[model samples]
Target: MTNPFTRRPGGTPGAHLPLALCAAAMAVLALAAATGLAVDGRTVLGEPVWLKPFKFALSFALYAGTLSWMIGQARRWRRTLWWLGTVAAAGFVLPEISAITFQAGRGVRSHFNFETGLDSTVFAVMGGAAYLGWLMTFAMGVFLLSQKRTLERPMAWAVPLGIAVSLAGMSVGYLMTAPTPEQAQALDAGLKLATIGAHSVGAPDAGAGMPLTGWKTGAGDLRVGHFVGLHALQALPLVAVGLRLLARRVTVLRDLTVRTALVVVVAIGYGGLTWLLVWQAQRSQPLTSPDATTLTAAATLLGAVALAAAGVLLAASRRVPARTPVAATR
Candidate 1:
C-alpha cells in the first residue's frame, strides 16, 4: 500500500518519522478517548474502577508523542526546541500556581494508584503535560505554515491567536486551583504537579465516577473551560488538516471545503466557551441548604448546545468526503 506521508509534495525527507509518530499518538489517543467514553457512559451500569487510570497515562503519552513529532518535523529543530521549552515552562509554572491554591484549601494531598484510582496529583500533572504537548505542537504548526508559500498569512494569525486564547483558558484553570493566601505558602509542589498531570488526560468528568470536584470546589470546576479551550489547539487544526486533505479530490469545491472546516472549528471553539461559562455558573451555585436544581438546569442547557453543535458538524462532514482522484475511479 502507498504510504501517506511518503507521498508528501516533492517527496520530503524524514516523512516516515512524522507519520510513525502521528500514527502512534493517534492510536494511543484513540484508546484513551474510547476508554474514557466507555467508562463515562457505563457510569450508570456499574461502579467506576481504578483500572481506568491507564487512560490518563495513555493520554499524556499521546500528547507527548504529538509534540515530539511536531518538533521533529521542523526544518530547524533548534528553534523549535526553544518553543518546546516555553511550553514546558508553562507546564511547570501552572502547576506551581495550582499547588498554591490546592494547599490553601486545607485539602488533603490526594494520590492515585491501581487500587484507588485518580486524585488531585494525577489531575494536575496529566493536565499540565498535555497542555505542554499541545502548545509546542501548535507553535510548530504555526512556524511550519509560515514557511509554506500556499498556507502563509491566514494560518499564521489563526494558529497563534488560537493558541493564545487557549492558553488564556489554561491560565484560568490554574488560577481556579489556587485555594487561599493562608494556605498558599504551605503548598506541596510534588502533589500539585501530580494533580495537573491527571487533568492532562482529558476533559472534566471524562471518565466515570471521577467526581468533578476540585479542592477549591467551584473555582476548579471553572478550569474545565481552560481545558476545553486550550485543547482546541490540537483538535481544530487537525480537523482543518483533515478537511483540506479531503477537499483535494473535489477540485471545484476544495476551497469551500477548507473554509468550512475553519468555520466549524471557530464555531465549536466558541461553543466550548459558552459551555464553560455554564459550568462555572453551575459550580458556583449557592447551596443555601443543599439544593441542586440550578446546577442541573445549567448542565442541561450545556448538553443541549453541545448536541446541536454535534448535529451541525455531522451535517457539514457529510458534504465533504475524503479525497479520491477521479483518474482512479475507472
Candidate 2:
C-alpha cells in the first residue's frame, strides 16, 4: 500500500494535506485582507470595503482547520472519499473567497449586487458556490454518523449533533435570498431591480449596524443566527472536550452516561438558542433588544435545559462507584 500520508502515532489518521494547505492559504488571505482594512479606508454598505473579505477569510480558515482536525480523527476512511471531499470543499471555497476579495477590491458588495451584468454573474456564481459548500458540509456531517466508535461518548455525541445544527444554520441564509417586499413591490411596478436580496429586515441595508459584524442594531438581522449556527461546529466539540477533561476531577463528569447526557442537553439548548435568534430576527427584533415574550422564551429554554441536566447528574451520582475505604484506618 502507498504510504503517501505520514501517519500519526497511536492509530490516528494523518491530517488531510489538501485541506491543511487550503487552511494555510486562507490564513494568508485573511492577513492580506486585514492589511487592506487598515489602509483602504473605503466603505461599502456602511462598513469598510475589506471587512467582508477579512471576515470571510478568517471564517473559511477556521472551517478548513476544523475539517482537517476532524479528518485526523477519522478511522479506516477510504483515500478516494477523503480526496473527493477535500477537492470539492477546497475547490468551491477558494474560488468563493477569491470572488469575494475581488469584489471588495472593486468597492462593491459580492452578494446581492446586480447593478451590472458582471456583478450579477459574480453573485450567481457565488450563490452556486455557497450551495455546493453547504452540500459538502452536509455530506461530511452524514459521513461522521458511520465512523468507528474510537471517540468517547461525549465527543461521539458532539460531532454529529454539532454538524446537524451547523447545517440548519447554513440553511438560515436562504431566508436572505428570498425577495423582500421592496423587491416585490418594485417588480409589481415594473421597476428595474439592481439587487434581489438583503441581510436586514424591517430596516434598510447599510443602516445603523454594529461595528465589524454590520448586524443591524435596530432591526432584524438574519446574519446573527447564521453566525451562531456556523460556530456550533467548533463550539459543541469544544464543550465535549472540556467535559472530557473535567472528568479527571469532576465526579459527575467521570461517568460516561453523565458526560454524554450533558453534551446532548447542551446541544439541544444551543440549537434552541439558534432558533430563538432566528425567530427574533424574523420578528424584526434586534438581538440586544428582545421583547418580554422573547425573554420569557429564552428563560424557559434555559430552565428546561438546566432541569434536564440536573436530573442527569442526579441519576449519575447514584451509579458512580464510591471510594474504597482506606484499609479500615489500620
lDDT tens string, model 1, 111-181? 22111233545455645654564555556555654532333222333444445555555555444444433
Q: Estimate each model's TM-score.
A: 0.45, 0.94
- The predictions' CA RMSDs to the true structure, in order, are 11.0, 4.0
Clashes of each: 25, 0
lDDT per residue for candidate 2 within 49-130, as digits (tens), equals 9989988888888788777777667775546437645865666778789889989989999988889999999888788888
For residue 191, model 2's alpha carbon misses the true position, in angstroms, by 2.5
Show the lowest summed lDDT stretch of 10 residues, model 1: 107-116
Score candidate 1 by lDDT. 0.43
Q: Model 1: runs farther than 4 Å from truth?
A: 1-55, 76-145, 148-162, 180-220, 245-252, 256-330
